[model samples]
Target: MIDETDESLNKSSLVFGNFAVLVVFVLLVGGVYLWVSKKNKTGQQVFPAGVNYLSPKGDEAKKPVLLYDFAKLAESSDWVTYKGKIYPFSFQYPKVLTPLTFPNDRSDAVTFKVNELSPEQSLLFTVETISSRDKNLVGKPEEFAKNYWKFFSGLKALNKITKITNEKGMTGYQATYVVKGKNAITSDNYFFVVEGDDEILLHIGDIFPTEGKAVLNRLVNSLEYKK
Candidate 1:
């Protein structure tokens, strides 16, 4: 025979068990909502789209070493290459100098101006190919500079015409000369190069001031004859 008291206690136990389960379900739903709301408020993407934020990793990943820093890399060297169209030679210039530009006449000469100079500025570097058309034309360095007022007129030789070997082992002639401009400001240095069929003249002026001697030397030293 079943007791009435026992049956009543069994019914109360069943109701309490169901109520406990309902309370747990409500708490779980509320926790998930709170988590999503917090993430949205913070504007944080815990993981990429379609990725499970709850995924686990065995260990933390190592930070990658950055290989590129444009500003710093630019400091290493601002070299720009220029290939000769008439001759088989190549040279480089720094950011302070402009790239070589051929005039509309496309004569034997190519000119590179100072980056900071105006059109009226007198400071510039030039390379001229001794046109093969003139078999009598000598490939000597001074042949290109004799008529150039800055290289010949009032020229005080700073150093003897010396043999210079570029990085590529192409031997050339180099001589530094002192010349004064119309403004009466004396340029302490002028550099010249004479190779196979080409001659280069670098006229020192306000663009390459007295304080930039080392930089100017480095730029000149980078010249190379591709041939």
Candidate 2:
């Protein structure tokens, strides 16, 4: 009789350890697969299937190489005008995109999305009201944009500020910045700063990258202020 009870205990312990190890191995494989699915080489990061976790990121974060053409937009007929209800301005967006007004009001801004898919998400469109009294924006939208970005949290770096003009021939400033995180990337998401009257400034950020920077260029250039 070679210690039968002790042998049984050792056998049970070995079985449990092996089971635990198997479970851990499975979990590790699943986690790696998920991460690889999320991040891509071209910088396109895909969000998991769900509305709660969906937000703009990845390839759209890269600073766009500026190659703006306004004529194509002029020739295109697939756009619809989104007039501001609270502000004295209007812009055009592609008909393929659906616009959702936040708070059920256009008083703030509008979010446009082709779908719930990530890496290529909504275009964050908003015409913000900034104080016109700020001396930074007195005559220079560029300065206003530069000064505005200073307070942007997690600002990792700033791209060269470029002078941009809209289709209406109104002047604005385009600026790009990188935020420090996997979710917020650097490059290509363009922010346009337009000087309002002596009491207001309009800030628009084109966040839709799936459709290409040309679409963003069209949207920015289509902006026209009635006031």
Candidate 3:
């Protein structure tokens, strides 16, 4: 026979165990409800705000670098492809940069100010298209590139003229000069190609070595001719 005292103890233990489980379940459900109901002063849920605040800042930090990676992988990335209105040649530039076009210039000129880099003088890019008639078709593109600096007064190239061959084997020339009264070195790039009977000269200018010379290099290297 079962002991009477043992039966009483068993009944009491069962009641206490059920009560303990019920208490725990209630606490858990209540905690979830409180968390779900929490909101800001404007009655918007806090969790979404928390996620938005944290997630976007982490992504925002990476954007500037993606824009600044001019040499390594910009053309392959999300940069916008631009075909010159002044000329038929095409190239890619960072999407974050807005293009400023000149309508009245003798040569079709486009300028973009690169804000990602830090320098006292600021990094600026200017490109123009000059016809063979304007420059007077003379020698090869490299020869014209070497002699073209003579037009500018008091500005002499500080570095030796360098020949740059792009991925397509298209050749371009680069020259850097120390401008008077400026602390930075100014870089100039030139690419020559023929379209029909016209010898086309494409010029990109004024990138500081201390600031964004790689960007200038990338831009020059990215050039493509339709003609």
Candidate 4:
């Protein structure tokens, strides 16, 4: 009877030991699973090696400047009325020609004029009406870009463009091109243009390097037109 009792107690103990082992195994497996899930949730793994980290809050990185009011510029007398249309009065020295108008079939059209100070030195300004569609006009920006390089390609070219920026710190380009002739005389031409919805302004002035580019930039920046 004592042997039988001992056997029964040993069996019970073995069963209890097995149950305890199983509970420990289950607890270890659950802990491992929870740790792996937590790591994935925090984006701690390297998805692509050597890739740079990006800021999650990128929208708050940049602040934009406020544009100047267009209406306030229109009221100034610096604007002169020509052919029933008002244009900003430019400096008188460079000498602007009679503006030539080109009528597009649509409500938007283009007007162009060339200001020639000398045989090899000239400035061209074109004012065009713009619409939503016109914003993406083919070669618009490229054509404007060529003005800077065109002077460099001409024969006996002695010109360089300087201090080019647009009005509103937005849509505009400017440059000063200097030209030298065979007689060793030198001339400077300055060009500026501002674009708007109903009208555009073009300024071409003779460059006086000693006078610096600030004068021309101020004039271009100060330009205002009627809506």
Error of 2 at 43 (Å): 21
List the RMSD of every prediction in angstroms: 26.1, 10.4, 21.6, 23.7
Better of 1 and 3 by lDDT: 3
As for candidate 2, its clashing pairs are 61-186, 62-187, 62-188, 63-187, 63-188, 64-188
Candidate 1 weakest ten by summed lDDT: 47-56
Error of 1 at 65 (Å): 39
lDDT of each: 0.43, 0.55, 0.52, 0.36
Question: Number of the top candidate by lDDT?
Answer: 2
Candidate 3: tens digits of C-alpha lDDT, residues 143-204: 65665544443344444578776765666676554333334333454554443433555666
Mind giving the per-residue lDDT tens digits that candidate 1 earns over 117-160?
33333333434434432333345555433323332334432433
Best by TM-score: 2
Question: Which scores better on TM-score, 2 or 4?
Answer: 2
Using all chains and alpha carbons, the TM-scores for the candidates as numbered come to 0.42, 0.54, 0.52, 0.29
Off by over 4 Å in 2: 1-76, 104-107, 115-123, 132-140, 181-185, 188-196
Ranking under TM-score, best-scoring first? Answer: 2, 3, 1, 4
Candidate 4 residue pairs in backbone clash:
158-178, 159-178, 160-178, 188-207
Model 3, position 4: C-alpha lDDT score: 100
Q: Which ranges of candidate 3 are over 4 A from the true structure? A: 1-76, 115-137, 178-185, 195-198, 206-211
